[model samples]
Target: MFVSELMSTRLITVELDDKLSAVKEIFESVNIHHLLVIESKMVFGVVSDRDLYKALSPNIGTRTETSKDTATLNKRVHQIASRRPIVLPVSATIEEAIYIFNTHNISCIPIVDHEMEPIGIITTRSILKALDEKKITLLATCKTQ
Candidate 1:
C-alpha cells in the first residue's frame, strides 16, 4: 500500500516566527502529535508534542507559575523544531515508511509534493492502525474460508 493511502490529510502547520504558545493551544485542543513547520509555502521542519513539553516550564498554569515560566511560551517554533526534516513523496510505499521509521529516530514523516509542500503526514501510529485493520480483514477472510 502507498503511504498516501494511510496518511492523515489533516495538517496543522506553523511558521518559524510563530510562538510556542499558539502551538501549545492547538495541541491541547486536538488529538494530534506533530505539527509541520513551513516557510514560503514549503515545509522545512517539524515540532512534536514532546518538543513543546520539553520547551515549556512544568510549572505553567500552576499556582507556582512565574513570569519567567510564562516567558517560555514566547519562544518561536524554529527554536525548538527539528530542522531540515526527512520527508517522503505521497507515492512512497508503506514498506519504505516502515524502513525509515526503523532506521531514524523520528516519530513521523511529512508527505510532500514536488515543490516540498506538505500534503499529508504519516506516523508510527498510522502504520500500526493500518496493520491492525489489515489483520482484522485477514482474520475475517480466513473465517469465511
Candidate 2:
C-alpha cells in the first residue's frame, strides 16, 4: 500500500523560531512524541520530546550555541533542524518507506507532495500497525483456504 493509506493526516508542527517553551507545552498537551518543523509549508526537520528536554536541561557539557544565539543541549536535532529536512513523498510505497527508515535509522518521515509541501507523517508505529493487520488478514485467508 502507498504511504498515504497509512500515514496520519492530522499533523502537529512547529516553526524554527517558535520558542522551546511552546514546543514543550504542545508536546505535553498532545502527548505526542514528535513534531515536524516546518517553514513556508515545507518540511524542515523533526523535533522529538527527547530533543526538547535535552535542549531545556541545564547540563553544561551538552549545550551548543545556535546561529540564533540559543543553546541546544541535544545538538543532533538542533543541528539537523537548521538544514532542509529529508522528506518522503506521500505516493511512496510502504516498502520504500521501510527502506528509508531502515537505512537512515530514523523513526519517522514526513510525507510531502510533489511540491515538497508537508502533508502528513509516517512513523514506525504506523508501519507496524499496517504490518500487523496484513499478518492477520493473511492468517485468516490461510484458514479459509
Candidate 3:
C-alpha cells in the first residue's frame, strides 16, 4: 500500500523558533513523541522529546534560568532540531518507507508532496498496525482452510 493510505493527516508540528519549553509542553499535553519542524509550511526538520531533554540538561552549557522559573526561558527548536530528516513523498510505497526508516534508524518519516509541502506523517506504529491487520486476515483464511 501507499503511504497516503495509512499516513496520519492530523500532523502535529512546531515552528523553528518556538521555545524548547513550549515544545516540551506540547509533547506532554498531546502525549506525542515527536514534532515536525516546519518553516513556510515546508518540512525543515524534526524534534523529538529526547532532543528537548538533552537541550535542558544542566551540564550541556549555560543554565538560562534558576530554580524559580524555567518555563519562561527561551531555547530555539532550530538549535536542537534534527536537520535533513528522512522525508518521503506521499505516494511512496510501504516497502520504500520501511527501507528509509530502517536505514536512517528513525521511527517516523514526514510525507511531502512534489512541492515539498507537508502532507502527512508515516510512522512505524502505522506500519505495524497494517501488518497486524494483514496477519489477522491471514489467520482467518487459515482457520477456514
Candidate 4:
C-alpha cells in the first residue's frame, strides 16, 4: 500500500504564532494526537500530544500551579513544535513510511507534495489498520489452504 492511499486528508492545523493554550484546547476537544504547523500554506513542523505534555508543567492536576501551566501555554506553537520533520512524498510506500517511523522514533509523518505543501498525515494507527487488514487476508488464505 502507498501512503497517499492511507494518509488522512482531514487535518487539524495551527499557525506557528498560535498559542500553546489553543493547541491544548484543540487536542482536548478533538482527541487528536498531532497538529500540523503550517505557514503560508506550507508545513513547517509537527506538534504531538507528547510534545505538549513535555513542554507543560506536571503539576497541572494540583491546581496550585495552574498559573505556571497557563504561562507555559502562552508560548507560541513554533516554540514547542518540532521543526524540519521527516516528511514523506505522497508516493511513498507503506514500507518506507513504516521504516521511517521505526528509525526516526516518530509517530506521524506529514505527507507532502512536490512543493513541500502538506497534503495529508500518516500515523502509526493508519499503519496498524493496514497491518490488521493484511493479517485478516493472510489468515483467510491459510484457512482456505
Q: Is candidate 2 or candidate 4 better by lDDT?
A: 4
Q: Please provide TM-scores, in order, for all candidate models, with all chains considered together.
A: 0.92, 0.74, 0.80, 0.87
Best by TM-score: 1
Candidate 4 colliding pairs, count: 0
- lDDT leaderboard ranking: 1, 4, 3, 2
For all candidates, the clash counts are: 0, 0, 0, 0
Q: Model 1 off-target regions past 4 Å?
A: 135-145
lDDT of 1 by residue, 52-72 (tens): 999999999999999999999
State the displacement of the C-alpha of residue 29, model 1, in Å, after optimal TM-score superposition. Answer: 0.6
List, residue by residue over 122-144, the lDDT tens digit for candidate 4. Answer: 99998888777773244356469
Query: lDDT of candidate 4 vs native?
Result: 0.87
Against the true structure, candidate 2 has what lDDT? 0.73
Per-residue accuracy of model 2 over 74-141 as CA lDDT, tens digit each: 24444435355568887788778877888886778889998878888888888888777783244356
Winner by lDDT:
1
- Order of the predicted models by TM-score, top scorer first: 1, 4, 3, 2
Stronger candidate by lDDT (3 vs 4): 4
Q: After superposition, how far is residue 6 of candidate 1 from its true place, in Å?
A: 0.3
* Model 2 pairs in collision: none
Give the TM-score (vs. native) of candidate 1.
0.92
Off by over 4 Å in 4: 135-145
